[model samples]
Target chain A: MIWNERIECATRDEMRIIQSERLSETVKRIYHSVPYYRKKMQDAGLTPNDIEDIDDLRKLPFTTKIDLRDNYPFGLFTVPMSEIVRLHASSGTTGKPTVVGYTRKDIQMWAEVVTRSLCMAGVHRNDIVQIAYGYGLFTGGLGLHYGTENLGASVIPISGGNTTKQIQLMEDFGSSVLCCTPSYALNIAEVIKEMKVDISKLKLRVGIFGAEPWSEAMRKEIESKLKIKAIDIYGLSEIVGPGVSCECEEQCGMHINEDHFLPEVIDPETLEPVAPGEIGELVFSTITKEGLPLLRYRTRDLTRLHYEECACGRTLVRMEKCKGRSDDMLIIRGVNVFPSQIETVLLNMSEVEPHYLIIIDREGTLDTMSLMVEVQEQFFSDEIRKLQELRIKITKQLESVLGISVNVKLVEPKTIERTAGKAKRVIDNRSI
Target chain B: MLIKQLSVFLENKSGRLTEVSKILGDCGINMLAFSVADTSEFGILRLIVSDPERACKVLHDNDFSVNLTEVVCMNCPNEPGALAKALQILSDNQITIAYLYAFSTGDSANVVLKPDQLEECIKVLQEHKMELIEASTLYKI
Candidate 1:
């Protein structure tokens, strides 16, 4: 079920040529139409002519989230307002969101890539996809919606939340495919069990889960609970939401649509490209995007890329599941820790639920990290000593893995807040 | 010989106890006997309620972590050495009481005991002719 096989199955040489030609055009367009990009290029003493091929990507200055914020709304858009047909923005926790625009052709291109992403996951024209990702300002909802429609599949565009309705529609519509964040999928599974719905009666077969990084252990949990094959799809709103790459049925790694979105992994400290297949921060260059053709945008997502062709017969470069976002990496007691590492450890244990919260605070110049975990109901004991022993066991494991002592606090089940979108796992109280 | 006790997990904070009491009070669930084991971080609120099953359900509905545990409830004379004599019987038989709490009513006191060996502790107490309160009678009171 390889959609757009001509580009998806292109050889390395073929992809390189396609990428080089598109990248050259994208660079020239931004340099001429975007003052921000033109000034950035001028400051770097580089011209659009210098970017002759994909290899010349290093010559251009990197675009970061801060740069997008500084430009604000429509500052970096290459096309005029008349040409921009749609806009989607990623919500910023502190201030204004990062806005991205798309022309009519751009939207069509988005749908094409997303359609290819769905096909990679084994979805076809006959399958009904229930898109549970949040709609509106976020790109996940509409991004997946158009793609599902583009694939000629039936789409139940019932956006996020309203768990009961989601389940009802799932049962009524006989949706064969599901799309949403991994956390929301877990929440749906929990609700289904609570409602005593017989999952066998549901026709769901495959799930395309993304928008946030999830662990392999979580994938297993979702698979066993929902009785469906959960495929990981990776994308951010900044560089054409959720269709930048997606895992094929092979399930080894996500195949990046490199012909359209050129991928690079670089060391955050030195900004130099990491050796092939090495873990580093991911950067993207929109090769064929029109409305918002970014040069080299630092995605801040950390992952490694595999150049070998996948068993699924797609020669698109595959990226490992994101380890964690570099921005989410916390430096506590001078030790760099990612919430995903703690998530991996928690998911491995059978006595605790996957829900957890990491709280970091400063006391008298000493940094402290306290983890609150919920004990499984079956594991709860009337005796305090037994519960205390479980706490100590968790603390010891975390200390050994994190190389820093962590205060483990045992909370009751459902104590941690669950969201329909990304789960907030860390709370840093330290002002500095 | 065996009674159900509702044990709840409460984080150490102001008004948490009030919240639990309010939930039970609103439902007309009476607390027969109760105890709280506290730490700096959290507290375990152990309670003997008139309706254990209903109380557990209501508390759970209110998002409180409540569990039903089996404990031995015995009636002891409301006088000095009465509790000690009953406890001495279990101590003599090498049966350990993990924790115990009591509430006095009229001439007798109702004592709830959670022992390391529940069945063995009940057997030892019955052999010694200690009057154990029936769960039904305790709930009625």
Candidate 2:
């Protein structure tokens, strides 16, 4: 079932050889064509020749989203505008979006990697992939679209919204492979229940969910609800969209496309590499990109990398699910609160479901955090004392885990607004 | 005798209590008696209603966390010493009352109370020969 067996299941020595050659070529190309990267390396007193292999990646200057922002629209692109065939940008709420461009070969490489990703999820040529990721400058929709086509699968490019339609088309089209953010998948599952569509009737057997960090609890919820094997896919617009890596059928860790992308885990504080299997910020270097190949780009995602062989028979190095992004960590009254940590606590409790919103507001100079949790149908009843006890129990568990007392509010089922994309979990109203 | 009481948790908002009462009123469920317990952030509304299950259903459907609890009700003589006599019997029997509220009706006063030990309080009341109102009779009233 391995899509690109030579690439995905390559031995460590073979991958190192391919990565070494690609890294050398990419570093030289970007250094000569991209002035932004050239100045960065010149200022760091290094040359493309200095980066002879993948080991020399540490010697290169690290590129970040801020660096891309400084470059703005096409300042970081290594190719001419005429040569670039496609362009995509990360959704930026504030100012300039992080722009990415691809030459024809780069787009082909993107398709190849994503084709391999779909194959890892057991999607075949005969399978139907319903892509719900938004199409446009956001790379997810089109990236998966082309990849599904490349894999010879029938793709339903039903891009994002109109939940009822998404479900109807999914059933009518007999979609076997579903691609979207995990939160949107959950929203679809909720709508399916609301519409009383029998889940057993749907042809979904595999799901490729990503674009935001999700937890094991969420994976379990999506899998059981949709009756599919939920596989986590990881990518960014900077790293050639949603096929930088993917979890195989083993469901252990995501196998990074090591031949095209070099993966590294570095300690966020020290800016040094962390020990194997230790958590740190994930860094990637695009070795085969043609349009805007980057060198040592810091991803800000926190996760560990495993190099061992997978039971699914892929030797491609795998990365564990990201804990959270460094910037996504919320400091609540001097306590660190990760939405994943709260998710972990909620998923362990039987009375409450994993759907929740963390609201942080300020009173005078102090900060206050409130958790709005949905009570399960079996848990929600006419027993006020039991509800109060459940609320208190959740509050205590959250307080113990977060080291700050959280005001737990019991909300009715499905009261929270479900988005067709990444779920907004934290709302800090201190500024407003 | 045990009487059913409905307790609801409400956010400390201006129109929260009104919303609960309005929903109950619209459902034609009459509140026989009720009490409010408040903290800085939230409040609990304990009610003795004509139909506990129906009132609870209506309030819950309106998104209120509601519960039903069994409370002891007693009929005391509507005299100055009548209340003191009932309290003395319980105090002597070592049965503590968590909370109690009384309303006078004609010549008799009905007092609803939550006791630490329901069986002990009832046995003490019967031994003292105090009139205990049956829930069926109270509901009819």
Candidate 3:
């Protein structure tokens, strides 16, 4: 079931040679085209000539989200706007987004990688692929869309939401493959139950779910509920999207598309590379991206990379599913949520105190966020209706901002624990 | 008059009620009345004690979600029809009782009820010539 067997089943030395040539060329290109990267290299007292191979990649300074944010809109693009054909952005620390641009070649490369990913999930030319990922500024939807097409499969470009219609199309179109976030897959399963649609009627045989971290238990739930093989795919907007790596049929670990993107795990605190099979923050170097070429970009996603050959016969390096993040970012239902984002919503409202605690838990297969906020002394009321209204107001504001429903609990003033140092913001009890 | 009632939240677990009672007993807080309101998962144990503030402090120190609420306590005659007459007055006045528990002491039955409208319930009971037990006398009894 290995896709692109020539590349995927390459020997360790062969991958290094391919990675080395690509990395050297990418370094030289960025050093010449992007001043930000040139400055970082110059600051490190290095030149493109200093990086002769993939081993010299460590000599280059690591790029971070903050660096991306500092660059803002198109500052990171290596090519002119005329050459860039597409753009995708994920949420940044502030209101602005971390932007990525893609040239035509880059788009084709994305399609190829994702095609390999879909093929790894056992999808083929005859399979009717359903792209449920959102198709807008986010890269998940269109990334999978073109990739399914590139794989010579019949693709249904049905973007996310409209659960009822999605089910109808799944039945009528005989969609054999589904692509979306794991949580959205669960949401679809829920809607399917409510609609009472006969699962047997649908031809769904496999689901390639990603765009957020998920657990084995969640995979089992999705598999049993949808009666399909639930496969975990890994990608982020920074280094392509939804196709950087995916699980082969063996399902042990996701095979990283090392030819297009290079992954390195490092201790987030020490900035030192970790041994293989050790968990650390994931960093990527998009050696093949034409528009936006990143070198040693810190993704902040923590996971372990395994070099052992998989049963699927892919000699490419496989990474365990991301365990968690090295930062304070929280993913709720596939949407990134920062406690500071919740803080911004609370501080904007006048009736509540600034103190809040975010509690995240797993209710069955879905993740739930419950925010406990303290009420101001003047705004506190004995009336249950008034308190409920305040809770609703907070919930609505948070939902609008975070793009996920939140349960808000308004407590008495000073009910939230006060800490002299950094306040504890999130309490995650999920076993995942 | 309003009596201070201690409401302690308890997870529905074995020995949770026993733990609360033990804490109160160890603190030497005499419980005059106790009742439990529960669903399947959790329960609220409501107690009228000799020293409610101290009992609340002890329970809270033990990590219980404790709150002090005002409940109205009135004496009903120790007869079958006596309770119905007092309830009819509340029903006629459109006052809803959140919960109620009764205990007999000294030939009279004491009915401690948490009404939806505490102030209105007191006023209605006073107009109906019902003897409302103040916290001081009720604690001693």
Candidate 4:
């Protein structure tokens, strides 16, 4: 296959030369317009001039979720609220939701980044893309909704939750591309099988699954079932949503749109920056966003950065598929096991449903993980002996995937609760 | 004429039925007739215990979600088509079987069914042409 050579061939010196000036201008804009940025810079004893180059980004104070909340609504916005054309927010799981705003230019830039991500995943104007993510304050749906439309593709805005309806629309409308959370994508695939909706008969060519964390095993399963390319998109509502970076056709790493968003890996423990190719929290700084131009925003997502050019000709910074979050990491048996890793293995198994709950409990001093997985009706045996056998298989899979042995409980169909929005996969019940 | 005293909701699981059984057993309440209506989420544990008020309190105290029902318990023989003939009676009166379950003591099987679209299955039984057995008759049996 012919690789995208132009982007790959761009000299590092030239890329840095471009990122420096844009980064400098973004720093100046935030510092002048938003009081939050002014205070952050003042406390750090740094001026916009101090951030002369990308290397000087360390001299700047890091932005965080608390800062966003402190500046609730639009206080942190660089532009006036009147100029903002659109706004989005995160799932707001902890407390209040982190909202984002987009100006007319920012919306165009968002569409551009999403389009770039889609192109790397080999989507085209000829494809009929289905948007299944939530389309409200949550950015997953609307971001992709606009980007797919902007790309000139025939858009099917099947805003999530009604799996049967999504399947019907996919088949009836000849949708060639699907975008939703990874778990939902797997769910739609299951419904397609039960409904016997011929995916091959449909026009689906590629799938961009994101919003919540997923694993490679899920990607592989979705690919086989839908018989199309499955790619992961990375973004948070604080920065933008579902379009900061995306998987290239090679599916190795997600190509970050370095032109708009600059990514950095920071030592979460030390609050200092780490070199590329090291696992650390991924940080991003938006250059062209009007509503919220985050400078050195701590994404809290753990991943390694790759500065290499992609097969799809895009001169952008790239990051590996995120390993897991620092907060959600379960240190069991001297190893950190991500629930997504366990999920990956389960999705690969034919007997398991993608719907599962990672129940974290304390057994003595060590943390114990019990995977509550749903089985299709046929394999759901009530006999404890049969359930034990199934549990053992899951335990082996977990040990192999996560390098930690965990107890797997085979739950009956629909035993695990389903969420209408982002699915809550992990239930850490360690406190009580 | 009599009414089935109670229909309690219980989850269909290992210790669920055992827990309910132990509650009534410990309360010194004799189950004159009892049956279970099973489904995926939960089952209705219908009973015509000798003292339903005491039985309801015992089961409720044990955390079993209970409901007071007035179901018509029909005594059917263990012979072929015995259930068919009894069910034909309800069908002839257009009484739908919401759910039904059976439990037999030595001689007769007490089948409890909640007729369809009726607030209480007792009123429907009164409308039918069958003789209703009362609590005393159930205790004597």
Clashes of each: 0, 1, 0, 8
Q: Which stretches of candidate 4 lie above 4 Å from their native place?
A: A1-10, A329-432, B1-141
- Quick one: ranking by DockQ, best first? 1, 2, 3, 4
Off by over 4 Å in 3: A348-352, A378-393, B1-141
Candidate with the greatest DockQ versus the true structure: 1
Off by over 4 Å in 1: A329-432, B1-141
The residue-by-residue lDDT of candidate 2 on A264-340, one tens digit each, is 99998899999888999999999989888888888888999999999989999999987767666664432335687
Candidates 1 and 3 compared by TM-score, better number: 3
Cα error of candidate 3 at position A329, Å: 1.7
Candidate 4 RMSD to the correct structure: 12.2
Docking class of 1: incorrect
Q: Give me the candidate number with maximum TM-score.
A: 3
- lDDT of model 3, residue A50: 98
Candidate 3 chain A, run of 10 with poorest lDDT? A377-386
How far residue A414's Cα lies from its native spot in candidate 3, in Å, is 2.0
lDDT tens digits by residue: candidate 3, A217-250:
9899899999999999998888998889999889
Residue A362 alpha-carbon offset, candidate 1, angstroms: 23
- Against the native complex, each candidate's DockQ, computed on alpha carbons, is 0.21, 0.07, 0.05, 0.04
Model 3 / residue A278 / CA error / Å: 1.8
